[model samples]
Target: MADLFVAGGIVTALEDAAVAVGRLDAALAGNPLRRAWTFWSELDAARRHAGADGRKVDLFRLAAHLHGLPLRLGDTASAPERGREIAGLNYAIELRSWMAAPDREQQRLRDIALDSLRDCGGGQPALVATAQGMLEWLAGQGSRPAIRAAVPLYLRDRGITIHRLAAVTGGDSLRAGPVDPDGFTVRFLETVGREAAEGRDLLLTMEREWRQARLRVDHRAGARSNSRLPAAVDLLAASPLLSISALAEALGCSVEGASRMLEALVQLEVAAEVTGRTGRGARRLYGLKRLLPIRAETTAVQRRARGGPRGRPKRVLIAPFAELADDAGVADATPDAEPAEPTRLTAASFDFDALDRLIAAADERTRGVRRLLDRIARGDKPFPTADGTEEPGAA
Candidate 1:
C-alpha cells in the first residue's frame, strides 16, 4: 500500500510537471513577457507561494528573481535607492492600471495588482519568464509540435539563447547530434503539435541551444563575491539614499571603515563619485549609486537569490495537498489516512493586540527619528542620538 501510494505520488508529480511545462511553453511561444507586468506580477506571487508546499523547487524561486530584471538593469536609481525607484515604478504601474481598466468592477482587481506592485518595488521580468518557461516545458502537455512552433517566436521575442534557455529552465537535460533514444524529441514534438520530424530536428536544435544559453547566463550571474563586503550592501543597495555617516551609525562601524568601502564601490563603478559638502565645512563625503545598465547587477542578484535554477526559493510553497489527498482517496481503494501528528499546514488565525502595540511603538520611534533629522537640517544646533547631552553643531 505504501509503495502504491508513493507510486501514485510519482505519477501525480509527473503530471504536475507536464502541466507546468505546457504553461511555460505557451508563455515562451507567445512571449507573454509582453503582457505588461504580468510576468513580474505572477513571478512575485509564485515567489510568495513557492515554498508554500514545504519542499523547495529552484524553478519557482528563479522565476521570482527573473521578474525584477527590467527595472534592475535599466533603471538609473542606486541599489539603495531601489525603494524609491520601486515606489516611482509602482506609481507608474498604478497610473497605467487606472488608465487601462475598462470597467469599475475590474478596477478593484487592478488596484490590488497595483498594491502588489508597490509592495515588491521593482525586479526583472525576463529572467522570471524564462525560468517559468523552462518549468512549463517539463509539464508535457497538448502537442509538442505546436509548442515547437511557438519556441522560435518565443526565443526571438525574448532574445533567449537556446543553450541558456535549456539549462536553467529545468527538465531532463539533452545533448546535440542524432536525437538520443531516451530523449524528449518525440514527446516534445507531440506536445507542440508537429506531426513531421523535419521541424523536430530544428526545434531540438533551438531547444538545446536555448538551454545552454540560459545555463551560461545563470552561471555568470551567480559568481562568488571575492571581496568581504558587508551583507548590509544588499540591504543598503535596496535602500540607497542612506548617507555614509548614517550608514556607519546604523552599522555601528567607524566612519573611516565605511568610507573605505565607499571608495571601493567608486572604483568598481557600482556607485558614482558624488560630491556631498557640509555647508560650514570643506569635508566632502562619498555615496554609492547603481551603475547604468542596471540589468547586469539586478539579474545577478536575482539569480543568486533564487538559488539558481535547481534550488528552491527561501519562502514557503503551499501545494493544495489536502485537496489532492481527498481526491486521491476517491481514485484509489486505500483511503488516505491521517498522519500521526496531523501534518497540519494551515495555522490557526488569531488577533494580536499586544503585537499591534509593539508595532505602534516601533512606528513612533521611526517618526521620532524623522523629526530629529528634520530638526538637524534646520538651524537647530544640537544633534540628537549623541552620548550624554546633545552637542551643538559648529557655527
Candidate 2:
C-alpha cells in the first residue's frame, strides 16, 4: 500500500509538470496562457529526494523532456509517435532490468508482462505492478486456496479473464483449494518447464454442475499434467521452422490429432500458423507469431531508457592469465578471465513465435481434457476405478 501511494504520487507529480509545460509552450507560441512554475519547483525538489534508481523520477524527467520537444519541433505531425517511442523505450529497458534480478518467478512474471504489453500495444505498467505483487505473494504463499485466489486477482487486474488466466497459469478453481501449495507451485513450474522444454502453453480444465444450491464437479484433471507439457513444449520451442508431421511425431499423436491441436491453438488467438499447407496429406507448420512488434520494440526501448543491460549478454570479453599464484606468492599475477556466462533467454528475448507454440500446446491439452470430461459426463466413456480399471460404459 505504501508503494502504491508512492507510485500514485509520482504520476500526479509528472502530470502537473506536463500541464505547466503545456502552458509555457502556449505562451511561447503567442497563445495566451496562465503561468505556473510550482510544478517545476516541486519536480526539482522530488528529483533531489529521489537519489538513484527512482524509476518514477526518471519517468518525470522523460515526461518533461518530451513535453518540450513537441513545442520546439513546431510541426506536431510526429509528436504522438515520438511520445509513444519514448514510452516504449523506457518500459523495455526497466522491465528487462527487473527480470534480471535474483528472483526467478519475478523474471517469469516479467515475461508475462512483456507479452501482455505486446498484446495491449504498450500499456504494461499495470501488468508489471500486478506481476510484482503476484511474485511477492508466491514467494511467501502457504495455503492452496490463498495461492489460487491470488493468481486470479492479479491476472484479472492485468486484463486477463478467468479462462485466459487459467489457460496460462493452469489453475483450476474447482480443485485449487484442496491441492498442496508446494505441489501446486511445482505443477506451475513444471507446466512452464514443459513449455520451455517443448515450447508450448500449459492448460487445465474441469466440469462442474450445481446440486442443492452448490456447484459440484462431475470430472477433473489433476495438477500433475501441468508440469509435463512444459517439458514437451521446450523440445519444440527452439525451431523457427515447424511441420505437421514433425509436431505429430514430437507429440506422439496422429497427423489428424496434431492438426486438430494446431487448429485449437489458432482459435485461442495465441499461436500463428505459417502459410502454405500441402495438398494430399501435407504437413503444416506453426510459429509463436504475434501480429504486432510494438510491444517487443517497447520492451527493448524500455531497457535503453533505463540505461541498463537488457539481461542478454551482447558480447563476451576474454583475457589470459600472466602468472599463477598458489598462495599469493607470485607477483604481478594477471587474472585469467573465465568464459562469459551462457546467455539465458529471458521473457524479453522470447520470440513470440516460440510463445505461440506453447500457446498451441496448451490449447491441444485443453481440448483433450475437455473431450474426455465431456464423454465421461455424457456416459459415452467409462470412469476409471481406484485400481485404474475402466468400468463398462452405460447402456
Candidate 3:
C-alpha cells in the first residue's frame, strides 16, 4: 500500500509539473522581453545556488558588473573573492546556455552522458542513467561542488532539451540529503512545478507593468501623439538599464530629447533613475519603476546631503523692466499676460535643516580645537605660528 501511495503521488506531481511547464512555455512565447527574462532567471538561479553555498551575491551588482558598469563604493567584495564568485556565476549561466544549445550540440552532450553511463555499467532507466553519468563525469573532474550544483541544471536541461518542458531549475528542492533516487525524483518534479509557476507569474507581472507604464505615458501626454513614448517604454522593458545616449540612439532622437522624455516618464512615475548620483559626469541609469527591483544607490535625502542635485539646476531669468511709454504712442499697447511663476534659484537655495545638521556635526571638532588652543596657552604644548615656528612665549 505504501508503494502504491508513493506511485500515486508521483503521478499527481508529474501532472502538476506538466501544467506549470505548459503555462511557463506559453508565457515565453512571443514575449518581447524574452532575452531579458531568461537572463534574469538565470541570474536568480545562480544567486539561489550561491546562497546555498553560504555566499551572498547582490543581484543588482552582478547585473551591473555583467553589463560592464562601474561598481559603486558600497560593493566592498575583495578582488579575489569577487572574481571567484563571478566565475562560479558565469559557469552556472553557461550551464543554462548549454542546455539551450542547438540540436546538434545537445545531441553531443547526450551522447557523452550516455557513453559515460555505459562505461559505468548502467542498468538504470535512461533519464536516471544520464543524470548519474553526468555526476560521475563531474566527480572524475574533481568537482564535488559542481556535482551538487549541477543536479538542478541537469534536471532543468533534461526537461528543456528532451521532455519539451519549460526551463526551470530545481535548486529550491535539491537540499542536502542522503542520496535516494525515488525521493530525489519526487522533489525534483515538485520543484519544477513550483518554479515554472513562479516564472509564469513573473512574466505576467512584467507584462502588466509594461502595459500600465504605456497607459500612464499616454495619459500624461493627452492628444499630443508622442509616438516615441511607447517605444521608450518597450526599450526600457527589454534592457536592464539605459542611459540617455543609449536611449537616444535606440529612439533615433537627440540626447536632450531623450533626457526630456525620461524626465517626463519619471514625473509620471513610470520610470525611475537607478543611479544615485546626479553630479557632473555621473553615469545615470534608468529603468521601469515597477519591473526593476533596483533602487537608486542613494535616496533623495542622501543625494541632497551629498550636495548632488537631483537633476539639472533650474534656470533663473531676470525679469525685464517695464518699458517707458513713447510720446507718440510708439510703445506696444498689447496687454501683458499674468506674470509667470518665479523660477527658484537652484544653486543658492538654502536648506536650513541641513545647515543645522552640519553645524551640529562640527561642534565636536570645534571643542577639540578649543581644548588644543587652551593647552597651548598654558604651555602644555607648543603652539605653531603662521610661519610654522613655535611661538616665542610657548614652551
Candidate 4:
C-alpha cells in the first residue's frame, strides 16, 4: 500500500518539475544577456554545491579569480587552499569547454571512480552495480552538477547532485531524506519548483534591467551614428569584465580606439572602470556601471575648491588713510575741551569681571540642566517643572 502511494506522488512531482524546467529553458533561449545569465547560474550552482560540502565561496572573489585577475592583498593568507577549492568549483561549473567536448573529462572521472571502486573489493556487488549505473546515467545527462556528484572520486564528496537528479527523474529510487522515498521526492520536487520559479523571476528582472540600460546607452549614443558603440555596449553587458585589449579584439578596433570608447562611456556614466586604479598606466578593467561594483571615490571627478583664492589676500594699506583720519579729527575735536585723554581701549580699562561672572553662571546652569536631564533619563528623578522644581503631585 505504501509503495503504491509513493509511486503516485512521484508521478505528480515529475509533471511539476518538467513544467518548471521548461519555463526556465524558454526564458534562456536566444536572450541577449544569455552569456551573462549562464555565468550567474553557474556561479549560483557552484555556491550551492560548495555550501552543501561545508565550504563557503565568495562569489565576487570567485568572479575576479575567473577573470584572471590577481586576488586582492588581504586574501593571500588562505590563497592556496581557497585557490584550489575555487579551481575545483570552477571546473565543476564550467560549461563552455565541457559542452564543446565533454567525453574526455567524463572518461577521466569515470576511470577514477571505477579504480576507487575496484580497490574496495567486490564485496557488495549490488552497491557496485548501482554505482556503475549512476555513472552511466550521469554521462547521459547534460547537468554538470549531477555528473560531478554521481562519481565518488573526491574525499569530501556528498552526493547532492544525484539526490537532485533522483528528484527530477522520479523513477530513480534514491534516499533523499531520513523519512521515506515518497517524502524525499515530494520535498525535493517542491524545492526545485520553487528555485525554478525564483530563477525565472530573476531572469526576467535582469532582462528588463539590461534592456533599459541598453536603451539609455542607445539614447546617449544618439545621431553621431557610431555603430561600434552599441556593439561595444552589448559586449560589455554580456561580459563580467573586460580589458582594453580584449575589448579591442572583440570589437575589431585598435586598442586606442577601444580605450577612447570606454572613456567616453565612463564619462557618460553608463560604464565604469572597476580596477580602482587612477593612473593612466594602470591595468584598467571596465564593466557596465550598473551591473558591477565600482569604487565611487576612485572614479568621481575631483571638485575644485570653492570661494575666493586659496590663501589669505595680501595686506594693503591706503596711502590717504592718515590724511582722511586727520580731517575727521579736526572736524570732531571741540575747541575748549582739554584734549580728552585720547579714549584708549586697553585690556585693563574695560571691565570683564561682570561678564566673567555671567559666563560662569551660564556654565553652571548648563551643567545643572544636563545633570537634571540625565537623572530623568535614568528614572532617578521626576520630570522638572517650569521653575526647575519636580512636577507637583509627582512621585
Candidate 5:
C-alpha cells in the first residue's frame, strides 16, 4: 500500500511503508535471514503492482540498459551486441504473447529469444539467462489461454537467477524456476501470477464474446468479415491499442474510414478513445475496455475538470540505476560496475529516516483505504452524492 501510494504521488504512503517495514525489520532483527526475506517480499509486491518495470517495449529498453546492452536509434555503425540484445528482448517479449497462441509459433519465438540471449554479451549475463529460462518455461507450457504478462529476470552481476514465484491461487502458474531474492522481483512475480487465472479466463471469454460481438456487428450493420470495419474488428480484438493510421492501412481504406469505424464502435460502447485528441490530423489511440488497466491511477496530468482537490502529487519514475545505461554511448559509458547494494528499489535512495516517514504516511492511507474498502463491502459506492458530499451515503 505504501509503495502504491508513494508511486501514485502519496508521500504519506512512503512514510507509512518505511515505518511499517522499519518496525518489522527491527522485530525480525533477531533473525537476519527472515528479516531479509520479509523485506524483499514486501518491497517486490509494491513495485510489481505499480508496474515500475513498465510496458513490453519499456521492458525491452529497461533490460537492455540494466544489463549494459546497447540499443541505437540511429543508422550509424552500431555494435553487434546492441542489435543482438534488442532483437533478443523483442523476441523474448513476443514469446510471452505466444504463451496463449498456437504451439508451433510459440516454440519458434522461444528459440529466437534463447539463441539471442546466448549470442549477446555484456553485464548481467546471469540476469539475461534467468529471464531466458522463464520465457523458455512459459513457451514450453501447454497452450492454455492465459493472460499475457512480463516476468522480471535478475540481470545483476554474478549469477543468473529467475524469480520463483508462487501461484496467487491454485492452478495459476507460469512454469516455476529459481529466482533472485530482491525487493522488486516478487513484485513482478505476484503482479503476473495473481492475474494468471483471470487472464486465462479473460482470454477464453473474450475469444467467445468477441466472435459474438463481430457476429452482432455483421448482423446489424450487414458488413462482411472481410469488409473495412469488420476486418478492423479482428485487429482491435488482437491489439486493442490501435492507431487510426494503422487501422486505415490494414483496412486499405482512407484514414477517415478507419476513424468512422472506430466511432461506430464507440457508439456501441465496444471501444473507447483513450487519448481525447479530436483534430483530424492529431494523434490518437483507441482501446477495448478489457485492455485498460484495472483500477488505474488518475495521474496529476488528468485533472478532475469538475470538483476535486487540485494539488499536484509527485510521481516517481523507477530508474534502477544511475545515468550509466541511458547514455547513447552505452558501449563506452563506464566500466561495468558490479552493484554494491542488492539493487534496492527505493529509487529515491531512502535512508532509515526517509523510509520511516514514508511508511508512516502509508499507514494512514492504509487505514483510509481499508475504510473505503469496508464501505464498498457494505454495498456503498466510492463516488459523490447529488449534493457532492463524499461518504458512503445514498447517491
Candidate 6:
C-alpha cells in the first residue's frame, strides 16, 4: 500500500509538471514567480502540518522537482533523474536569479547536467529514454552546439567568449568543442523572461530602495562640456554593462575618447572594468550594478552616505543573532562561565512595551530609529529584503 501510494504521488507530480510546461506561455506572459512561489509555500505548509514531514521544500528543490518531473517519470525502474533534476533545476534557476552565482554552485550543477546527458546516450528503454534524452538535450542537450546559445543573452552582452567564460561559467575545468547544445536557446529565452520579471519585481518591491539607489547619471552632466559624455551616462543607467566598441557606438565618439569616458565612469564608480587587458588587441567590459542583472541594492545609498552634503551618515548597529540574550538578559553559559540552570524568557515573549521604553530612553537620534521601525511595522514605509520583496512591517 505504501508503494502504491508513493507511485500515485509520482503520477501526480508528473501530471502537474506537464500542466506547467503546457501553460508556460501564459506563465511567461504574466508573472513567472507567482505560481512558482505559491506552489512551494503551500507544499511546505502541508509538509509542516503532516507532523512526521518536517522536511521543508525550498524554491530550488521545488523548481527542480517540477521542471524535471517529466524526465523522472520516464524511468520508474531506475529514476536517478529525481536527484539529477534537482541539479538541473538549480542550475537553471540560479542562472536566472543571480548575475554572479557562486563558483561552486555553477560547477556543481553543470557537472550533474553534463554527466547525466552522457549517461543517457547508451541504449535505454524506449519510453523511458526519450524524456531522459530531452532532459539531457533540453532541446539540444547532448550534442555540442553554439556556446553563445548556452549562455544567457545578458551574459553574451557582457562579451562572453571562450576565455571570458572560463572563470564565470562556474567551474575551473574546461570542456572543448561547442559549449551550447540544442534547445538551449529556447531554455535561455524562458530563463531570460523569468529573469526580466524578477528584476522588475525587485525594483518595484521597495519604494525607498529604488528611490535611494537610482544611479545618478545626472550628477556629472553639468560638469562636462561634451554632450556625448552626458549621453554616455544615460546609456549606463539603461545598460550598465557594455563593451568598449559598444560604448563608442552609443556615445558616437572615437574609441580613444570612449576609453577615456569609460575610465571617467570607473573613477565615478558608476562602472568598473570587468575584464583584464593584455598589452594589445585586448577587449574589455565595464559593468554597473544599477541596471538589469542587478547586483547590490545598497549602491546609491552607500555612495550618498560616503559623499553626501552631510559628512557621513550615522551607522545603526543591530545586535547580531549570536549576541541576542534570553528574556531575562541571560544567555547560555559558555565553557569559561559557571554552569547554571538555563532560564526561559517569559516576559520578553508577549509585549514589547519594555523594549519600547528602553528605546525611548535612548538619545534623540536613537529614539528616531524606533519611530522609523514603528512606521515600517505599520506599513507606512517600504524597506528592501534579501529575496527582492517588501515584508511591510517586518522591521
On lDDT, the leading prediction is 3
Clashes of each: 70, 31, 0, 0, 25, 5
Question: What would the TM-score be for candidate 1 when compared with the true structure?
Answer: 0.21
- The models' CA-based lDDT, in order, is 0.32, 0.32, 0.53, 0.48, 0.38, 0.34
RMSD of each: 22.2, 27.7, 22.3, 33.6, 25.0, 25.3
Residue 11 error for model 5, in Å?
44
Indicate the residue-level lDDT of 218 in model 4: 75
TM-score for each model: 0.21, 0.20, 0.57, 0.52, 0.32, 0.27
Q: lDDT of candidate 6?
A: 0.34
Q: For model 4, how does the per-residue alpha-carbon lDDT over 1-395 read when each residue is reduced to its tens digit? A: 12222256466765665467556656665455545555455545455555544555555554554443445434455768855765554543342222112345555654555444344423322222323344344345534344433332221123222212211221123323434434654555555565555556555655554455556767876886755676666666665566776677766689899999887777766676765554565557787764343322122222222563543222233210112221366557676553221221122312233223323432343344334444755887455666766663321
Positional deviation of 341 in candidate 4, in angstroms? Answer: 92
Q: For model 1, what is the alpha-carbon lDDT of residue 108?
A: 51
**Which pairs of residues have clashing backbones in candidate 3?**
none
- Ranking by lDDT, best first? 3, 4, 5, 6, 2, 1
Residue 146 C-alpha lDDT in model 5: 24
After superposing all C-alphas onto the true structure, candidate 1 shows an RMSD in angstroms of 22.2
Candidate 4, position 361, lDDT: 38
Per-residue lDDT of candidate 5, residues 306-328 (tens digit): 46556432223443211222226
Best by TM-score: 3
- What is the alpha-carbon lDDT of model 4 when measured against the actual structure? 0.48
lDDT of 6 by residue, 311-355 (tens): 222323321011223345345456566323222212221223322
4 or 5: which has the higher TM-score?
4
Candidate 1, position 367, lDDT: 39
Q: Which stretches of candidate 4 lie over 4 Å from their true place?
A: 1-6, 73-103, 107-176, 278-281, 294-395
lDDT of 1 at 359: 32
Candidate 5 accuracy as lDDT: 0.38
Q: Identify the runs in model 3 with alpha carbons over 4 angstroms from their true place.
A: 1-9, 68-167, 172-174, 291-293, 296-395
Stretches of candidate 6 off by over 4 Å are 1-214, 222-241, 276-283, 289-395
